[model samples]
Structure formats: C-alpha cells, structure tokens
Target: MTYDILIIGGGINGCAIAREASLLGLKVMLVERDDLAGHTSSASTKLIHGGLRYLEYYDFKLVAEALRERERLVKAAPHIIRPMQFVLPHENAVRPWWMVRIGLYLYDFLGGKMSLPRSRGLRKSDTLYAAPLKHGGSGFVYSDAFVDDSRLTVLNAIDAADNGADVAVGVAVESARREGGIWRATLSDWRTVEARAIVNAAGPWVHQMLGSLGVNASSNVRLVKGSHIVVPKLFEGSHSYILQQPDRRIVFAIPYQGDFTEIGTTDVPVDAPEDARIDDDEIAYLCEAVNRHFTTQITTADVTSTWSGVRPLYDDGASEAKAVTRDYVLELDANGPALLSIFGGKITTARHLAEEAMEKLAPSMGFRAHPVSRARVFPGGAIADFDTFHAQVVATWPFLGEARSLRMAHAYGQMLAEMLGGITDEAALGPNLGGGVTEVEARWLHDREWARTADDVLKRRSKVGLHLSAAETAAFEARWNAMFPREPSYA
Candidate 1:
C-alpha cells in the first residue's frame, strides 16, 4: 500500500515530522540510514533554551520561537527536560555591562509569558554563583533547560509509532523516481515502496538525497562542525557557566552526569558531514575558554570523552559559520509528486519546523493537517511532576536504589514500570552486564526502542558506555551481539 508521506532522515527534525504527520491522521513512514539520532542529533550540547547568544546576532525572532517551544516541551516532557540555572560572569567580557544587561532584558521581554523565571543580576562576590570564579565582578543569572537530546529524538519516533507511523531505522533509500504522480522508491532492504509525498529531512545528507533523486536545490548547505569535550567535574555547583571568549564567541561549562563536566563547542567550518571529529586544537580551545572563568584549570589530560557533529546550516551568505541563521527553510517541489527538502534548523525549533512542514505539504497531500496540540505529551511523558514521579519509581522498585531509580525515572519516565515488567526484586532485573546494563533493560531497548547494536544501547539509548572501563565495555559489546544478530543494511 502506498503511504501518504515518506520522510527521510531520523534526526530530531525528521522524527519530529514523522510524529506530527502521523498524529495528523496520515499514513506516515520514516526511513533512517542509521539509528535514530545516530549523528548530529545525539552530539548536541543538550540544552533546550532560547539562544541568548543569538541576541547579539539580532535573531530575536528565532530566540522567541525557541523560548515558546521551550515552555511547551517542559510542560509536555518534564522528565527528560528540566530547567537549569546559568551564571554569566562579566569579567573582561567583550560586551559592555549595559549592553549585556539590555540584551538580557530584551531576551526576557521577548520570552513574553514564558513560565521560566526572568534573568537577574548577580555580583561576582555572591557566593551562590561566584565561588568558583577566577575573577571578581558582576554578571547575571538566567534560566534555561537541559535535555537528553538523543532520547528526545527517540521519544518523537516512539510517539509516531504509537500513533500508527512506521519508523524504520538503519534503512536507506537506494533510489527513487516520480511515476504516475506517485513516488516509487527502493530502500536498502531491497523493497519497493510507494508514497504520494516525500519529505527530505536527511540533515547533512539532505542535498545528497536530493541529488540522487535527480533533483537540484536552489540553495546550498553550509556544513559547520561543532565539537564538545567531557572532563572531571570543574565545580561543585549544579548551575552552568556561560564563558565569553576573547573572540566574542561563547562557551558553556555544564555539570554533566554525576562525575563529569561537559564543555564545548567550537564553530569550525568543515566540508563534509563525515569530517565531524574533535581535534586536539579544538580541545585546547575549549579548555582555554573555560579556564578563563574557572579557578580550576584543566588540559587535554583531564579530558575523558569527546563528541563532534556537523550542523547543516543554510547558506545565508553569512561570512562566518557562527553567524549562520538557525532558522529553517522548507522547499516543496510539486511539479510531479510532492517533494519537500528541509534546510538549516536546530533541535530547539524542530517541533515547530515540523508543523510548518506539514502546512507546506498540505495542498500536495490533498488535505490539510489539523494537527494536535503542539504541547501533546510524548510517549512515557504523562507524569505531572517529575520529582514526585521519581519518588514513586523508587518506591515501586526498591531494588534499584536511589541513584539507579532516579536515573531510570528520568530515562523512561512512566514507562519504567513497563520496562521492569512488574518485577519487584533485584534478581528479576537480571545481571549488571556493565555499568548498570541489565539483561532486562537491554532487552526492552532492543525489542521496543529499535536498538540495533550495542553502540545504540550503550551510547545513544543510554550513556552507560561513558561509565565503563575499556575491558568491561568490550565484554558488554560481546554480550549484546550474542543477544541480537546484526541485520544486513545496504551502504
């Protein structure tokens, strides 16, 4: 049977589009060449906030749009996304005190009824936010949010599947042609499928996907590589620090996991998506950035793990990669069967982009989508209050202990009970394969969440790989492979 929509790419944007279209009563199917969020979606700074730095670039609209989405997402998925405090110290800063203050004030004003607390002034001597600072002065404290970026993408896919969409991971499109007003496509699985419309949200490879279809784009994709580094905890506070570099760029120092600090991201221009890998120079740049603000200094030796992803930004004629617009553009070519290609968007605005994409394709689809509320809750996101729900999870599974229960509550939310399979004892949870990897949880991810490989389970589904030794990681990989055989996917 021919589907109403076939979306390419499994990043946040693609998954979000699938979720939106599927929920709007369309027969939607999304195909991904790799695991969901296997690329840039999983390699983000993991924050859900209006880009405060974008204010300097005069992207007021983008910031406001993101702030609105931030409010909606926090209400819809409280477990995976939560508010966090950021301390912006103004010591030898590039922007003047008054300019910074006005920028933040404008930011708050633009937010306009956003539920988060407004930004406030903070003195460098204030111990609450200044104890770890290397210099003394005044700055500001503001509220944003943190997120499990990979899981956010996964949650969207799960919601789409729950709403009757076919989500195919590790599936590639080998070729496609327009015939009789229908898109006849062959996928990596050697199966031919038909769709009335196709949405190309292929991220960095979006242009490549278009080229293969013999379609040409009017605009080009600017590939910018963003890199991040993880190290031992820098400070004892839960609040993150926004460090202003001498080059007028900003770097973030965030508290990560339980024992590490996550800092990054360098805006280096790259030619290809596959060129995304953190370099020693990038590592030194991030270290130097944070060192300017923190009393505790670190170098490459202190680094634990690192990640890099190439952002596919629109070629907006910006002179620098950092200056590119985060706004997305949708190109719908409908001379034949409807074909839409998405260019340049961030995770924070993906949901809205999906909504706009649906509207763009409505005429081509022969019906407009009366989409559900933007705040519609994702799968496992029904809990009203996360802290209260967390306590209940600990109570339900006493064997998981406080820390493990808290982690599980955040990861699975209301679905933790389903994952536990009504088991009440530790023995029922199975063995700790490595770093809290249990036979039960791994099986659930494999069966329910489309975890194809151990890497998908270890790195993306959960960051347990970060907590394991080299030997233990290898052992867990062997065990995972023994549990599920690898599927054959085309190149």
Candidate 2:
C-alpha cells in the first residue's frame, strides 16, 4: 500500500499527528508495536494542565503554550477533561507567597481569554480549602484540568481513523529505506508500504529509531523516570493538593477513581525507558511529601498501585534531573524523503506538538497543511455543556444506572449515544464482565479502539482493573483470552 505519510507510534503524539495529517488531507497510516498508550503515555499523573513548576525554570513559552492548550483541550473534550481546582498550602511552602501569586497572575494572563475561574488566595480558616491540610495556614487555589489520559489518546486515534487514517496497533515497522523519492517500509506482518514522509513519535524509543531512519542527529535524549503511587482516599474534598517538598520538588495528591488518592512524581534519572519501576527512595519521598502537606499520612504499605513512566526528555545538560526541560524538540531530516522525530513532550501540548510536526513536514511531504487557531473537538467531544450532557445521558439511558451512565458520559461523551442508542434493555448491553464493563463494551473496544488484549481493555481502555478483585480479574482475563487468544495454536 502507498500512503502520503506513515506515522510510527500509537501514543498521544503519534495519534495526534495522524489526526492532524489526515485532517490536512493526507493518506496517513500509524503503526504501534503494542497497544495504544502501552507505555509512557498511559502512565501519566492523569492531568491536563500547564506545568506550574516549570514557571521557575523561566520556560515561559512552554508554560503559556501548555496553559493555552490545556484550556483548549478542556473545552474540546469536556467529557474526558474537566476543570480541576488545585490548592497549594502556604505553610512550609517551597516558594514565597508573593512569588506564587506573581506566577499565577502570569499564568492566567498567558492563557489569554480564559473560560475557567482565575486563581485566588484562600484563608486558612476557610475549612473548605483547609480541612485536609496538616497546617492551619492559608493557601492559593488555581484552576487546571484532569484527563482520562489513555482515553484521550484513543479518541484521537479513533478520530484519525474516522478521518481516513489507518491506525495499526500491535504492529511495528520492522525496517524502512528511502528509495525512488519515497520511503518503503516493511511491517512486522511482512507488508511493504510506501509513504512520502515518516514521523517517529515512538515516545521513549524515538532516539533508537533515528539511526534506522538514516538520520545521524546530534540531539540527546535524557530519560527521566517519573513514578506515581495510588493509595486509599487521603482527603475528603474533590480539589487536589499541590504539595511542595523541602528539596524544591512538588508532588500532587489528587482524588482518583472515586475511592483513592493518586500522588506522584519524582524526577529520577534513568539510562533506559523499558520496565521503569519506582525505588524505595522515590516512594519515601512521595510519602513524606504527602505526610508534610495533608493531615492524613501514608506509608509505602498503603500504596494500592504504582506506575512509573519514563520521560524521554531532550537533553539540555542540566545539573539536576528535576531541572530538565518538559518542552519537546522536533527534528526533521529532509535529506531524502522526510523523516521527523519528536522528543520530550508533555501531555498538555500533544495537539500543538502534532500541529507543529505536520507544519514542519508538510512541505517535504507535498502537502499544504491547514493551521488552526484553536483545535477542533475529537469524535465524541462535541458537547455544549458537559454536566447537561451527562444529565441527558443519564436520562436517555436510565437502564445503565446513574453511576455507570456518569462514567460512560465522561469517557465516551456524545459517543455514548452511538454505543447505546438502540438498546433499550440493560441486558442487551451484554453480559457483565466486571467493574461495570460488559461484553458489548469489550467488543466495541476491540472493533473500534483496537483493544487486542485484556490489559488493553481493562488497563488502558478503562481503569476497571483497579476496581476488580484478584479472582474477578482472573475470570475476566480468562474470558477475554478465550475470545481473542494470542496465537490460535491449532486454530
């Protein structure tokens, strides 16, 4: 098969790039070695926010651009992304109150015309903001957004497919060579395809792909491991806490999945990205940060789950790991057919990164890309108001139950109608798999979202694994294995 552009990787950046390229009228094909978001993309703090700490690095452009993108994403995908309030306590705060205020003022200004509430100072006696704090001191509250990170990536992939881009998950580009003014690539399935340009958005593995692309580049990728630990519910409020550590790093304790609090992330440098795991020191640091900020303390034993994502940051030769830039670097080698490599991007700016990537490669690929002032919503994100839409979902599909309907509304948005439109009975939704997931939903995930494995369905496609018991999960896994066995041994 011949295509205008071949994108390698199925993470957020790759999916976003495919959507942008396809929307710009390119016949695009995106290939991933594993399931979509099977790596760094899924293991995030699950936030869509401007890097508040990045302001100290004087990365004003990155912060402002991220804040703007955060706003746009919240508006575009209100179901999966919503405005969240963050409280930074005053006592034992790393930075002075004046500095934080100034920073927040700049943050609000950088966002230009804003839809969310502005930042403000809160009194310590104001128990609503102070109830969960360890100290009876004042704090600063600012607005950011929370996201279903994996779902966002999947929606972008789905939109790319809907826009005529072929999203090939569980497939890898075995080899590629530039010839006859086009790039011929061999896939793991032994299919040879030709494309005018290639985008290497392989997340942590981006640098390793460079040599094969025949682009001897000088840029370095400093792998930074950021880990998060999930523990039982810490605080009462819906608002998240931004706890500043004594070492000048900040950790967040955010409400997650209704029954637990998720806290993260230490910038521990690593040599490799594969199989990243948190060490005792990192866990201690996170626990201590939470202990110092909140009245409810936690130990390592309290950690219900943990995830570590390796950030493949563009090396800037910083002395400290925490000082590394969160901004991405895009290198295009148009020596022959175009080859673009992306490094070090925050989830908040994936769309913008994709746009810039397409803009950079459009000329070489023989396409005039259309630039957008603000990005369009994903396939299922067209909602005027999220709460009202949720209410409509609950009213329309009363059989799904309010709790299930609410979760579905957030995850699928307007797509819920398409999934559950004609089904009047709950049983028609399919047999219960566990954690509110059904056979029908699993089938939909497989057919539409390219969910091939149990992990792809429960872990990435949905966080149902977090809520299931060991036996329940095993049963579901067994059933899923039966449905889509990896290798059909004998057919």
TM-score of each: 0.98, 0.97
Stretches of candidate 2 exceeding 4 Å from the true structure: 487-491
In lDDT terms, which candidate is top? 1
Candidate 1 at residue 380, lDDT?
A: 84
Residue clash pairs of candidate 1: none
Off by over 4 Å in 1: 123-125
On a 0 to 1 TM-score scale, where does candidate 2 land against the true structure? 0.97
Give each model's clash number.
0, 0
